[model samples]
Target: MPQPATGPTEANTFPALCAHTHLFPGARCRLQGLSDPHAFTAAPWSIGVDLRFSDDAAAAAELRTGGPDGPVLAVPPYTTGAGTRIGERAWFVREFTWVDGEVELRIGGHA
Candidate 1:
């Protein structure tokens, strides 16, 4: 994981982690109601997410099935130059283990 920011605004934590891990945080990354999005200031890829369908179980199922259609939850591999957007595409639940309400995402991207 990247070092915790000295101060909130002093660091771009998401970009730093993506740079190190080459992966993004997905919808389950949320620890609260909603979080500000992230982008790579410089890197090889970017990620995007659409939470409009988060409340829709059908959408979630489609995402889990890797369907090409449905809510675009965890889109990935955006060019590094792509500008920052409202959400960050992230790892699937399979990448990490969730026990009870706790998550063990060892590769970072927790925003």
Candidate 2:
């Protein structure tokens, strides 16, 4: 049987984890779980990858557009920081919230 998905929570603050990847290079990872959650001792698990954002154009656009009340995302110090498309739930986590500020992607376990 398939287990339920893990929702966002104080511990699961996805944005902060992304920030880790932002601050430190190649820290964040994407997890595509197996359909059988019940088969595992714990919640089912699968493979993941340490990721870095690549949204140069979009980062600039976000800064230009600015949200309701904020300065917008600051430019990343390195090339891997900015890009037009950071992720794609169509292929990956496409529905995550927009993270404007610098953060560290804190993966569970190894933190």
Candidate 3:
């Protein structure tokens, strides 16, 4: 497993991670409910992540707290499988939904 990035200052680029895997720039992970993976870019100041969990229990646990728009959920620090570290400050759950045993979560973050 790759170690988490210490700070944004340590690197010039920060990529997105899903299930501890790196989604290389312009690459998207195929999930049930999401047509495109949530993406982050500094050039235009955009950030978002879309995750699909097949494990019902895990998905339920993630949504046990506030409602979809109630509270902001912080994304835990994680390094991609390729050894890249995502050092963003905060990422909150923007949307949550379940379908056919799959839980889809839409998360967003600030620049």
Candidate 4:
């Protein structure tokens, strides 16, 4: 008989896109780069991110028509040998610029 699925299986895994932004899977956006991927501090932090979308025109239009609230990006929790630990963090988009089919977002939040 087949054994039960282990941790972090692809079958139950989802992309790291921010669901709160609603510009993730629906917009075919993929994370391209992050200014600071690993930062451990409580002080206010700001990071720059680059996102590439399959449909540039549509993505730009969506961003323009977004609600008053900015997009929320998060880092999901994970499990380690010690135990499951919360690594979740939320960052609000301070501003975003789209140029040459690339979306650059400046996000800030408490880390």
lDDT of 1 by residue, 20-67 (tens): 213334423321111222211111111222222232211111122233
Query: lDDT scores for all predictions?
Result: 0.26, 0.26, 0.31, 0.32
| Candidate 4 structure quality by residue, lDDT tens digits, 3-111 | 2233113222212233233332223333323222121011112222232223221111112112345455543443333343435444454544443333344555522
Best-matching candidate per lDDT: 4
TM-score of each: 0.20, 0.20, 0.35, 0.31
The 10-residue segment with the lowest total lDDT in model 2:
57-66
- Best-first order by lDDT: 4, 3, 1, 2
Candidate 3 lDDT tens digits, 1-111: 222233222332223224424222222222232222232111111223333222211111121233343424334454444545545333344454443333334554431
Candidate 3 residue 72 Cα shift, in angstroms, is 2.6
**lDDT, residue 37, candidate 1:** 25
The candidate maximizing TM-score is 3
Q: TM-score for candidate 4, please give it.
A: 0.31
> Compared with the true structure, what per-residue lDDT tens digits does model 2 show for residues 1-111?
343453211122122223342422233422223233233224222222233343322111111112233222233233333332333221111112212332222222211
Off by over 4 Å in 1: 1-21, 24-74, 81-95, 99-101, 105-111
User: Lowest-lDDT window of 10 residues in candidate 1?
Assistant: 37-46
- Report the Cα lDDT for residue 6, model 2: 38
Query: CA lDDT of 36 in candidate 3?
Result: 26
